[model samples]
Target: MTEFRAFHNTDPPQLLKLWHAAGLGRGAAECLSIDAFEVLIFSQPYFDPNGLIVAVEDGEAVGFVLAGFGPNEEESALDYSIGIICAVIVHPNFRRRGIGRELVLRAEEYLKSKGAMNITAGPSGLLSPYLVGLYGGTRPSGFLLSDPLAAPFFESIGYDATRSIRIYQRDLLGPKPPIKFHLVNLRRKMQLMISDDYQAPNWWWLTRLGRLETLHFELVPKTGEGAVASATVIGLDLYIPKWEERVIGLTDVFVKENERSKGYGQSLLLEIARRLQDELITKLEWHVEESNTVASHVALAVGYYQIDTGIVYQLVSR
Candidate 1:
């Protein structure tokens, strides 16, 4: 017999055990420690004990679901209008017994009770409240297609795929990437600045990326006072134990509004790649929404190739 209950203080070890047994996918961190969960999940200021539902069988944990909400429009507070099911994992031996469905159903009820007008499965961009570095490669990029169980499991539970995010990767050891003439000229007039301990500009950014080992890069005019473009890369150290390769994931890429189409974005990306290659990092990944053609073009211009797709889902009747 199995029973469901809210998360308890002593449940991290059990949840970590279930995480290993569930086969979350390549994007998921392997060999995770309790400390990682402490920093990435439990320590978040917005963590709600009731939002994380766990399943117990014979007093052993078998599955869990983590649900939360994104920031409000002002990016200053939680927005209960859009609730997110950030993660759902079930132990392999305990699956096929409706445990996953029950967990999701309970998660839905919890979200609705909290005033959610919309419910989305898997976290992405501003919709993400946690699991930024634990699950997704770069940032929370919805449920990755590489996870064989995600699509079928969510669809069977009445969710429909409503958006797709393309995961792109570039080999740092490969031949030189294509460089446009405008980018070359842009580089001459701009200086590339790199920092390993840069500060977040706002509360929202600090909440999402504050705990990770991030590499920040910016492109600024040689004589200007501010950056025209910037990009952030996070060390995927958890992956190193499993993949045995030095890897970093790109996220929070930005270009000033007035700087768009001036080639600063591509220039900053190429410079970042060059610097990482020199540091012997083997791979870099960037996730872009399918609708963002401009970002896709920038990524492709830097020799990135599509490696996978992440799907974001919602209830059919919602």
Candidate 2:
């Protein structure tokens, strides 16, 4: 017999045990500490005890599901209309017992009770409300296909795949990819500005990335006052033990609307890669929507290769 209940303050130890027993993939932080959970999940201002459902049998946690809401269009506050089932983990020993399904059902009930009209499983982009760096590389990128269980489990539960996320990685120890002759001139014309003191542009940005040690890179034309492109990255020093390499997760890549098709994005990425290489960073990880051809091009132009993919699932209407 199994009992289900909301998370208790004392459940972290049991939950941590269940996490390792569940066999998550490389995208997940394997060496996560209780403090990591506190900073990444429990410490968030919007965290709700009721949003995390825990399954217990023999007075020990066996499985769990975490649910939360994304920010509104303005990124100012939670939009109850949209609810996200961020993660579902069931202990390996408890497999084939329907514990995972029950956990998700309980998560759904919690979301629906909070006025959610549209529900999504597997957090991605701004839809992500928890476990950003802890689960996915750099940012919340749905559920990685490397997990094997994610797609089948979610699809079997009536969630349809709506978006594809491509994870890319570049080894910075090797020589940087060569740039075009035109790009060389462009590089000379633009300044690559790197800074450690980046102020978040908005409340949502602050909420998501505030805790990480962020590095901001901007490409600006020598003659202009505005940046043509910019990118944000955070060091994954905590992952060094698990990955056995120094890593940085790249996110919030952007280019000015008027700067599109002018090679600014590609040049910015190459410069960023070069800088990371010079600093002895071993690897850089980035993810983008599969439909984003421009970003895909930029990443490939800088010698990044697809290392994995993730699927974003949405709950189908009855």
Candidate 3:
């Protein structure tokens, strides 16, 4: 008989074991470490232990799920409570037995209990912030498209593939692509500034109203020579830490509509890449909406290559 229960203090070791046994080690390397579990999942103040659960068969944990909400204050603004299925791992030995489905259903039930109007089988704990670490970022959002089982599995379990994302990556140790430019003196025309505050452009998931320091960039538009700044944020690039490799994961990049198509986005990325490269933090990565061809054009020009794809799945109560 298989039995399910809430999270316990002693569940870390078994959870980590099951994570690896489920072959999640590739995308979710952080979960392979007990310490990471403490930082990534348990460290979040928003984490709900009651929302964490496990399934056991013959006295062994075969499956587990972690669920929780975004900051409570943002609920009203969203018009619906958004909850995340931080993760769901089922041991390979137990596949085809429907354990994965049971674990997800249970997590959804708990999320609904906490006033969650909709649920995402995406990154949890750290709230809506994606790519904060190796957890949510390993793919794009919901699950890796390469996983084969991911798309169909979530669909069979009542989750809708709400959106698609394209992931990009490049190795700094490899050939560095030349910073090509079509706009004349683009570097002199715009000044790049870096700061951390809520006003910074970042991943949409970062709407939590707290003092979380977000590393962001802003490109000030300059019109004339004497430093008479237009004070317009023409474009920018932003990132968060991925401590394991000391890599700065690109979270967002944007250029004002009128400022776009002039090869400005690529130039902005070049600036961001140079700053990071100068600090020996050469590696950078990020994702864009699958339909965003304009963004993809600049990313490719700046040496970023297509790496993986992930989907965002959602289920609404009504």
Best by lDDT: 1
* Model 1 lDDT per residue over 1-318, tens place: 889999999999999988878887788888989999999899998999999999998999999999999897778889898999999999998889999999999999999999998999999988989898888788878899888999999999899999999999998888777657888888889898888879877677788788888978988889977999998899888888766898899988999998899778788888898888888899999999999999999889889999889999997763
Query: Model 2: per-residue lDDT, tens digit, 1-318?
Result: 999999999999998888777777888878778998888889999999999999999999999999999899899889998999999999888887899999998898999999999899888989989987688878878998988899999988889999999999998887678759978988999998988889888787787788778999999989977899999988887677668899898898999997789888888888888888878898899998999988998899888999999888999963
Candidate closer to the true structure by lDDT (higher is better), 1 or 2:
1
As for TM-score, the candidate ahead, 1 or 2, is 2
What candidate 3 gets wrong by more than 4 Å, as runs, is 30-32, 71-80, 124-131, 138-140, 195-214, 221-246, 316-318
Instruction: Give the TM-score of each candidate.
Output: 0.96, 0.97, 0.76
- CA RMSD of all predictions: 1.4, 1.1, 5.5
TM-score of 2: 0.97
Model 2 residue 166 distance off true place after TM-score fit, in angstroms: 0.6
Give the worst 10-residue stretch by lDDT in candidate 3.
Answer: 228-237
Cα displacement (angstroms), candidate 1, residue 122, comes to 0.3
Question: Candidate order by TM-score, highest to lowest?
Answer: 2, 1, 3
TM-score of 3: 0.76
Give stretches of model 1 more than 4 Å off: none
For candidate 1, give the lDDT of residue 305.
Answer: 94
